[model samples]
Target: MSNNINRSLIGNILKSIRVEKNIPMKKIASALKVSESTVSQIETGKNSATKEKINEICHVCGCSFDYKTDRKKMIDLVLYIYTQYSNLSTDEMNSTIEEVKSNSFISCSYVRFEYYLILYMDGIINQNNEDVQLFKRILEIGKSSFSNKELSIYYDIKALEKMYLNDSIKA
Candidate 1:
């Protein structure tokens, strides 16, 4: 992913965590010795936070921030959602959905498509038609550029969505 994308994702995750914990922007600014607007800019992705500043924000929010680890976790979560969604409890599913929605910066187009597929399956989002159109455009533009894994995910999403929308379809 690009640095700007990472910064935005990190900022979003920080903001989500802070909001979930009921920590105000002003409090975070006070703890970090920065202006509230600085905190707001960081959270809004208008400005990138330094590593030290990110650490301070996480510390104030009583959370840990590791960009690579979190990104990996998101990838794992997306895979789990795709392959084992039926096994997830309601609370687990809802929480995972919320986390994925908050940190919506999957760099891989296929993975991002799968994320959208899962959300559509859960009825949390209604982008099936748009997704289909986007996939068609991708296929037209760069069909041979996709990896085997990417194609596999695209097919899996199509099959799953098909079965989901039409219960008469058999395996």
Candidate 2:
């Protein structure tokens, strides 16, 4: 973990895959010959993971790190969308929205959650009912399965949905 290595997307992706494989942090720490605290910090985005560290983590979690594949592409796409969504110009934003809307590639729940989130944001920004309905369907799929980070986004989207309906005060 270093101060310069970006966290968030990569960290969450690592954590998500590790969780999916049922690999504990202690095990990953042992595998990487690092302390559990270091692994925990890396996973929680408090610290950062270098490329070598990311490879080791993906290896330990049995996740493919090959960027040529669709899984990797989708992960990168989601990461790019998540990291750049706010800074995107209107034209770039619309392009991303169209790209996401036209595709149905979901390799994992984390991706699915993020995909729906982009749609949810697009729905809010563009007032699109189809996107909103899709977001509701995703929320109904699972709340317990999401990571804490994803859960935070879920709550924010839920609140926004309520606000959109003018029922923010209700359950």
Candidate 3:
């Protein structure tokens, strides 16, 4: 999980989604058979929601939570989504970024390695220090677990980073 999807952001996302569906927090609390203050605490990030509670919320939203078990397929899906999102408007791109960042499908080592590869490319494209650092950190964490394909991408990102730095120096 990325640092971007912290407790507060998760709470906010849940709250916003509930509001968008015209569901009140009090109603959700009643459905969960919990006090309104408990739900309020979860929404404000003051308390953590159990897995069962999250599932209940998903049920209320008329959506099923997919705990993707297939690592390879999940990676493929993320790549496909990335390809499709490339041409999205800025707002849509931001939304997609947030969604990807929030999703925990990268729990698998291979998927996490692939995610870091994508993050590295994003850093190269944007030339941002934090993204570059994050990519490096992820690369280090997953270095031993990397497949040959990931190694290729890691090296490519390194080359791209050098080029970006050179261009910056010249500018």
Top candidate by TM-score: 1
Task: Write candidate 3's Cα lDDT for 1-171 as tens digits.
Answer: 433333443454455446545788888898899998988877666777666776687578555444444546645644544454455444654455556567654423225545555666555655656757755765654454444655655665576677777854433
Model 2 lDDT per residue over 43-151, tens place: 7778878778888887887654543334344445544554455565667777877887776444232354556666766776567776476466644444334456556
lDDT at 63, model 1: 62
State which candidate has the highest lDDT: 2
Candidate 2 local accuracy as lDDT?
Answer: 0.63
**What do the candidate models score in CA lDDT, each in turn?**
0.58, 0.63, 0.57
Which residue window of length 10 is worst by lDDT in model 3? 1-10
Off by over 4 Å in 1: 67-73, 86-171
Candidate 3: stretches off by over 4 Å: 1-69, 77-99, 104-110, 167-171
Global CA lDDT computed for model 1: 0.58
In the range 1-171, model 1's lDDT, one tens digit per residue, is: 667665665566566557646789999999998899999888777899888887788788776664443434444565566454556466676677767667544322224333443454445223336445434433333323334654565455556656656753641
Full candidate order by TM-score, most accurate first? 1, 2, 3
Q: Estimate each model's TM-score.
A: 0.49, 0.44, 0.41
